[model samples]
Target: MTYETILLAKENGVATITLNRPPMNPLNSQLFKELGHAVDEIAEDNSIKVLIITGSGSKAFAAGADVSEMAYLSPVEVYNFNMGSRKTFDKIENLGKPVIAAIAGITFGGGCELALACDFRFAAENVKIAFPETGLGIIPGGGGTVRLPRLIGVGRAKELIYGGEMIDAVTAEKLGIVTKVVAVDVLMEEAQNYAAKLAVRPSVAMKMAKESIQAGVNLDSSSALNYENQCFITAFASEDAKEGLGAFLEKRKPNYTGK
Candidate 1:
């Protein structure tokens, strides 16, 4: 499928979706719709084991939502727009396969929220991340309020969101928001290498593990354990599991078919 706001590429079990708008890839309704379509395509492709999301230029992964678009919107229209964005981000978070955010430059508001949806975030040394919505007299309407607090504790989340302060990549890593920080030149390379490594793992087991972890986040200890056990059973029943066990006994590498 064709997209105007994003570019999609697939190879070697890894798919990349690049936000094409340069300088500052502002999330507008058109971009959101295109992103949703790209995500859906990646989710349905069995050969694509992992996804990496990034922006076109080094200037920004994304700056924020298109304020120009939102400025003229009525309360009802803005609410609907935000709801659509929330749904798209939710899809990214629950994409079944691992998703990595290769972030650089400015990441604010909806941009920061989009990165939060990914399973891993690898930021460049030049990256600056924040949720500066409060400064705009608005709050994060793209799952930022919900996911950020859950990720880095309420205190730190509040510090970033409420203060509307931008933190460097290292600071974000120290706060547990960024998985790793790399040189700006090697950011995409590092992310792609990591994605390649994950793509080679047993797909069924990986998917189940991802699902278990995500589900456990909202579940109680006892219920989470039960759900994890169920996920384990499901993974254990896959053909890859049998091959993995046989390979272990035979002292050979396992060949996974993603079954």
Candidate 2:
């Protein structure tokens, strides 16, 4: 499908989605809606093993939601917008597969939240990340309040959100916001290399592991273990599990069909 605000492509078992509104791609309503559509497509397609999301240009991942779009929104409209973005982020978070955010430039406000939604993140040394919503007399409405704390802990999340301060990729990695920070020239190479490795693993185990971890986040100790056990047992019934055991006994590599 043709997209006005984004670019979508599939290659090397990876689906790459780029936010194309250059010069600090501000998230206008149209861009947000188009993002929803693009994300939905990636989620529904079975051929996509891993999803990589990033922004065009080297200046910004996304500046923030377009301020022009914000000025006229009623309180209810704002509420609806939050719900939409939350739903979209949730889809990526619980996509039943892998999604990685390749943060190349600036990641602020909605952009930071979007990256947080991904299962993993890779940032370049040139990248900057923050939740500066409070600077605008607002708050991070797109799961930043919920997910950021989960990713990087409450104290640090509060500092960034409340202070409206930006952190470079090095600090972000220290805080666990980004898994790795590399040079800009190797950003895509590193991200794709990771994706390629993930694609060859047991797909069923990966899916179940993702669900177990995400669902366990909100559950108690016993419940979390129970959920984890269920995922493990389910995998035992999969063909991939048989292949894995057989290959182990044969002292050979296992080939998974994603079954």
- What is candidate 1's local distance difference test score? 0.95
Question: Which pairs clash in the backbone of model 1?
Answer: none
Clash totals, every prediction: 0, 0
Best by lDDT: 1
Please provide TM-scores, in order, for all candidate models, with all chains considered together: 0.99, 0.96
Residue lDDT tens for model 1, 89-119? 9999999999999999999999999999999
- The TM-score leader among the candidates is 1
Candidate 2 per-residue C-alpha lDDT over 87-194 given as tens digits, one digit per residue, 9 for 90 to 100: 777878888779989888888998988899998899999998888888878898888999989888899889999999989999999999999999998898899999
Clashing pairs in 2: none
lDDT of 2 at 204: 83
